[model samples]
Target: MRIRRVVLLMAVGAALAGCGADGEPIQPTMSANVGVGTSGTYGGVGVGLRRGGLGVYLGL
Candidate 1:
């Protein structure tokens, strides 16, 4: 009984400690484009942006 109480208290304390302030949710932006012309070939480009204003891109 005593051991159970101590274990329960520790579990509650751990749960409270884990409840930290939430951080700003990430808002991302993404874009892609593809085009085909008279030729039998295609091209595409993609861009991505993250919360910190960082950007990544790919093209083919």
Candidate 2:
């Protein structure tokens, strides 16, 4: 699992490193996400938003 996560992160990093190579201006965009997880004794949900270079998150 650790190796897989490392590989996935490297792949994403490489992809993002190549973005905007054509000299195009960056555009503002808004996105929302939700995440949930649990362990042996606890779990929680998180909500998040990202706009351009800014981001926000809330967890419960």
Using TM-score as the measure, which candidate wins? 2
Q: Relative to the true structure, how large is the alpha-carbon lDDT of every model?
A: 0.45, 0.46
User: Which tens-of-lDDT digit does each residue in 1-60 have in candidate 2?
Assistant: 655654565455445435645754333232334555564354344334443675544444
Best by lDDT: 2
lDDT of 1 at 5: 52
| Cα lDDT tens digits for candidate 1, 9-40 | 54544444344326543333335466677886
Worst 10 residues of 2 by lDDT: 24-33
Q: What does candidate 2 score in Cα RMSD to the true structure? A: 8.7
True-structure lDDT of candidate 1:
0.45
lDDT of 1 at 31: 51
lDDT, candidate 2, equals: 0.46
RMSD in angstroms, all models?
Answer: 18.7, 8.7
Which 10 consecutive residues of model 1 have the lowest summed lDDT?
Answer: 51-60
